[model samples]
Target chain A: MSTFYFIAFLSIFFSILVISAKNPVHSILYLILTFFTFTIHYILLNAQFLAIVNFIVYMGAILVLFLYTLMLINLNKESEPVKPFMVKIAGVFGGGILAVALASSLKLVAASNPVILKNPDLGLVKNLGKVLFNEFLLPFEVSSVLLLSAMVGAVLLATKDPKTA
Target chain B: MESLTNTIHAVPLNHYILLSAIIFSIGVVGVLIRRNAIVIFMSVELMLNAVNLLLTAFSVYRGDASGQVFVFFIMALAAAEVAVGLAIIVMIYRNTNSIDINVLNRLKW
Candidate 1:
């Protein structure tokens, strides 16, 4: 096994831990680790700009939000209620089928005439900036609008009182 | 072309597929087993990340910058999702004082 495989395996393992852990805080911590591993993967792919952005946005900002949300709830319930045995069995069966289907399809896709890129640049921050401002400018601006809407909607939902008003 | 060829050869396709598979499974298990809405949101993020990984891999293989562009969009959408999702979760918590999604049925008419 190569170093890439090792790192990839580690990333997946930690991510699974993130989901499986009962404690929400622990899950968030594991998610942070998962994000870091993804940053490493991005670096390996030579997407240095993306790696830094991943670190800053996901590990830095998003994970913090996740943690804060968990804290705010203050359930004082130590452990989340375990899912029933029947649900667990169904989950395993469904997940297994999905994985098998995806794996076989991916194998076929990978084997069929592998695409090879030509003249691939480093795609540094500068290059990405240029492309964002030039070719992808419209979509980028639209995304800003989307974010604005989400923010406003969130505030409205959180503030509304069904009982009093 | 030369640089792309080297990059493609550097990372094998199986690596991407395996990562995607594992991450997707995590998301599935999360949605099935976890009752907390916030954690379920995180699980969905996991699934989106898996798809992003595959997208970037294909972009690299095909030597087109578009896939990365899509990843950028996905990230933006994810941030928006979290902002709105957390707010909704807060509302749900406020209403019932519980984040357990299974309990959500009582809120519905």
Candidate 2:
């Protein structure tokens, strides 16, 4: 229980840092830390396959891509324009409203006692693989197609015609 | 492992809900406040992660694998999103030499 609290605290802190950091590189680093804490949370939930997948796909691929783009673009703190104070205040106000609404609504939800797992191996990769391949095969195949299309679309969008320019 | 689940259950499920809600709110604030396009993108990722966390919590509580499977789908979708989204952002930067979303106001016909 203490460990969950500690991990949750670290994740919330790092998420805040990801947004508030002046340097884009620093923000990316903080985002990685946030992902790490999330990975811990997944492990605690006994979703081992997902915990590893989250670590590899998020912290490994997506964040590295973000970092590379930031570096490639060479964005500096000085180059980032500042928003007005009113806008910042409004943002905070909007977020606070959402937080209050969500928190308050949660109180109405009666906490149901979680069913204790008879076979704790449900989240293990072997078990997940069976469930994924057998029950969710259609979505699994569809997502692969989605990924392929996304890759092709990204390449097409990013490439330039030198002659046109 | 059994003891671990017990300990986790000792803490009410509402705590996880509140935590994810707070994180989601922060992401919302970040998206609204940040001017840089990349930062806004990061905030979107933060929101997605918040949803993912909530899904995992529910999955654990119910002893269901479906929620976790959905999380896997969400991750895949997020990856696809980032790939295309960042590519578009890069293309925008190449065209205007700036990634500020405000600069794209020409589209606001």
TM-score of each: 0.89, 0.96
Worst window of 10 by summed lDDT in candidate 1 chain A: A110-119
| Candidate 2 interface RMSD (Å) | 1.5
Q: What is the interface RMSD of each candidate, in Å?
A: 2.7, 1.5
TM-score of chain A of each: 0.87, 0.93
CA shift of B14, model 1, Å? 3.1
Error of 1 at A9 (Å): 0.6
Candidate 1 off by > 4 Å:
A110-120, A160-165, B1-8, B107-109
Alpha carbon deviation, residue B57, candidate 2 (Å): 0.9
**Residue A25 displacement (Å), model 2:** 0.9
All candidates: CA RMSD in angstroms?
2.9, 1.5
Question: Tens-digit lDDT track for model 2 on A143-164?
Answer: 9999999999999998885776
Residue-level error in angstroms, candidate 1, position A102: 0.6
lDDT of 1: 0.77
Query: How many clashes does each candidate structure show, in the order listed?
Result: 2, 0
DockQ of each: 0.52, 0.69
